[model samples]
Target: MCGIVGAIAARNVVPILVDGLKRLEYRGYDSAGIAVHTGNAISRVRRVGRVAEMEAAAAAENLQGTLGIGHTRWATHGGVTEHNAHPHISFDKIAVVHNGIIENHEAQRQQLKALGYEFTSQTDTEVIAHLVHHYYQGGVSLFDAVKQATRQLSGAYAIGVIALDRPDELVCARMGCPLLVGLGEGEHFIASDVSAILSATRRVIFLEEGDIGLLTRDSVVLHDKNDQVIERAVHVSDVSLASLELGPYSHFMQKEIHEQPKALSDTIEAVLENGFAAGLFGARAAELLPQVEGVKILACGTSFYAGLTAKYWIESIAGISCDVEIASEYRYRDAFANPRHLVVTISQSGETLDTMEALKYAKELGHNMALSICNVRESAIPRASELVFYTRAGAEIGVASTKAFTTQLVGLFALAVTLGKLRGRVDAQAEHGYQEALRQLPGSVQHALNLEPQIKAWSDKFAAKQNALFLGRGLHYPIALEGALKLKEISYIHAEAYPAGELKHGPLALVDESMPVVVIAPNDALLEKVKSNMQEVRARGGELFVFADLDSHFSESDGVHVIRTPRHVGVLSAIVHTIPVQLLAYHVALARGTDVDKPRNLAKSVTVE
Candidate 1:
């Protein structure tokens, strides 16, 4: 949930570190800091607020160096103050910047205290600084010192280290968090994310788990945990800097919301051209996917919701049983693994810590095959899986996901159709019809986007409300859940979702004129059942806001407001219905005057447990 960028270059690296942190600012942070080897001593500057404030301080100090590391902190183990910022130094010997949490930091701090080492900040990262500095004594080299120090740390970490005396080199290590070394001409770099260094270098070496890297002005070396030399492939990143630009939009969230149409087209174009097949997932998918008797999807947050939406499709269309689990909770529980079950993991960044751990645990329990639906191809989850489907929804900088979520749905629906065809559940005519719907999905999403003006009007009234209720029936309850999540995530509204049939069970007691109810009313078999539930809400004076299909024949009435969407695309209605709810959340947050891109207490990626 933090950002780390470092460079050992021929020219001054203070500007490089600052620029990298600015690019990484889309990942939410509360404090920014950087430490550089100034040829005399380590010059460290930290600020409690934005990256701009820290940049101003560096300019005032005239900070300059050839080697440096910078960090933007999200306050995991300490307060949001300047003293709690990163680039933590010890004995003026070494400065360290870290991304993940240290589970055993308290024990390490106490042991370091016994060695007469004084600590200043209340951060777990300070212990890392002291450990590296303490090991750099008695004729030990900087490379061996970092390697030995990392052997004792017991948690996820992606660290960048710079020593006062070693001004020409930088050291970095990765365990569970994502880290990479960027190779350049006459220079080298290290960063927790590739986006930080996209402007400087496109060639990158993504370090694997338990790998430590040593970077110098001219050479890059990598080693495994046993201190033996290792080799990893270097891949040029495909993310264009132009995609990172918010050209015409005020916020990245808004930009991503409007980009959903093109994003859907890019993600499903392969399905449109080649038709749905098991081979589309990967080379091994044809051999492994046909053997699948059950599916268990492991994901977190928005990806978990995507799995929930997929569950309805896989079961109904594919005629196969599917289960979705929250990856964080699945880690501590006992799972009954079956050899024929396909364990699927979904993540946008592909570096979600708990989901990766859960996949490992499933494999440990005798699950033989795994697949990943991810956006980043080189990320941990995709490499760890036997098969993968990459979503073409490029870099999602907004903390609240928009394009990434919808693209996951597209891949999931494709997977369901592929499985259905393989298991003899779907005939040729049905498969062709599904393919047509897949091709029309982009146009349908664009049709939903046309409701933005009406959604904005509803948001103006929703901004004054304190709570909201979202309702849906079969095949779309997950959409309602996602809608309620989006409302609470950005707009800061207390919201909840329930299957419309469950209204009388308990939630109906909260209904009043002050409460707003948002309904997902498409023209499906359950529409009449949902309408009866709407009548119950209207009887209790609860205002109703319905996103209905064009053919649903819904009309505005007392205490009821209807916004008609485009006609539903048969199997892709859930994805189309998702657009309006996302727009409502964005416009509502706009009406509330909140930060739409970086919401409070949330980061674009969850790299820690």
Candidate 2:
């Protein structure tokens, strides 16, 4: 994934472009560049590093212009170098910045080469610039030139273009990747995300697929693919600038971890107002949920783990069959499909490519009832679904998700309660008890956060380990899987999670003093079985680290270490158990001197499949 920003304003836009690129640094970029139209020529500056490096280069050049487009590249098609960076100019007439793959770039380049046009850099974006320049000379204006160029290209793209012939305007188009236009008083802006232009204006217009926008200093005009002018509504963004800042924490991950309590409270308070009723999901949830024969959850990565954790609750409490599938795999496999099933999709950004594609595929197969548990309001997944539950977790800047995962759990648990009541598995008294327990979730998560100092000590021990194993049974197995994923994603540790009963089958052989085993013992029905698995590890000279409940009364032995948590909160135990594991990952990454926010080769949102 990459970041793109374009501004056509009354004042110089170099500073605005730089500020917007800095806001999108969490999306993971290796090189940064900008091209500004100086009325007669396109002045370009490119650097092969972070935005700070590009900022210095821009300052040294003293680049000043009223219209410009900037990009932070993640290096998908070419090497990470200054020569391959964006604002790929062609014929020295137009500069373009793109945020997706051009599947037919090779064919386009061959045809353009035959037309006697030369290329400068090894980027697919250069082809787009040349195509527009070619069209601009064929008795067409700049707006029609860019629109005609986009029709020939294939695959996903969110492109921003600035032509030297038209210095007062910027043109942008979107097919699959996200692109939004920010509305200002005497200025207009374009960015890959709203956070890029949030400081300038809260009002924005999210561009739909196949929609092309022409942004001038004083006006914005949108058109569909068929060249018909269309009116798009402007929505106010609720994300504040302070939410994008790191405030007092050393890293965004740490700040997000501590903000879990507030995130959980805000997400659950919406359901409590509805008294955990079926209508809480949406208007027709009560009528549709009871008619559904089964439920299918489609997600990826951290969102997938949240769905896995809910599979336990939905089947146990609601007494309904539920299946969880990876979105990328579910779209390709020929599995069971029925129109009566409720297809649920989970994503933090709500723009995940695979999850959105899977949801669309299910809908096309006649599954009309779709639900989205997501964080962002204007993202594509939420718009594609029939009903939505927004996780008010605010802006999650960290590459490895922290607060979003926990908030998704809260949303899914609320869905379970509603479904349980609809199925006659839960009565009014039982629903009230679950509701009260949910009201205490914020405080319980805060209490779990107090165990950070101790978890930091465990992190010090974990920092030296090269391999680790996480063990859990039943409902907590998915939590163990999530914990292992957190450690591997941020800390670069090789870790695996298995059901505790599988320890004797094969994994126990790898357990030694050099390997550490983290156990999730929540004082449930499987506590004794998990304890027996721990003994198998201890007997093999392997060290043990256990996060047990307070009532479990686990003691520290010669080879075993235990950190007792607060009392378990029934179905909410999985949500509470996730806190210490997240703290462990953050602290371990800190101790290892790794990039805690943007891990290597990972972007915050997977916009490309």
- TM per candidate: 0.99, 0.98
| Model 1 Cα lDDT, one tens digit per residue, 1-609 | 999999999999999999999989988899999999999999999999899999999999999999999999999888998889999999998999999999899999999999989999999999999999999974597888888888889999999998988988899999999999999999999998899999899999999999999999999999987778999999999998988889999999899989998999999889888888887899999899899998999999989999999999999988999999999999889989999999999999999999999999999999989999999979999999999999999988888999999999999999998999999998989999999888888899999999999999999889999999999998889999999999999999999999999999999999999999999999999999999999999999999999999999999998899999999677789999999999999999999999888889888888998
Candidate number achieving the greatest TM-score relative to the actual structure: 1
| Residue 548 accuracy (lDDT) in model 1 | 97
- Model 2: per-residue Cα lDDT over 1-609, one tens digit each: 899999999899999999999999999989999999876789999999899999999999999999999999998888988889998998778889999888999999999999999987888888999999999989797888999999999988999998888987899999888999999999999999999998799999999889999999889999987789998889999999999999999999999999999999999887778777777677777778888777899999999999999999888888888999999999997766788888999999998889988988887777889999999997888888888888989899999998999999988998887788888889999989998988999998999999999999988899998999999999999999999999999999999999999998999989999999999999899999999999899999999999999899899988799998889878799999999989988899999999999998889988888
Evaluate all candidate structures by whole-model CA lDDT and list the values in order: 0.93, 0.91
Per-candidate Cα RMSD to the true structure, in Å, reads 0.8, 1.2
What local lDDT score does residue 523 receive in model 2, on the 0 to 100 scale?
89
Residue pairs in clash, model 2 = none
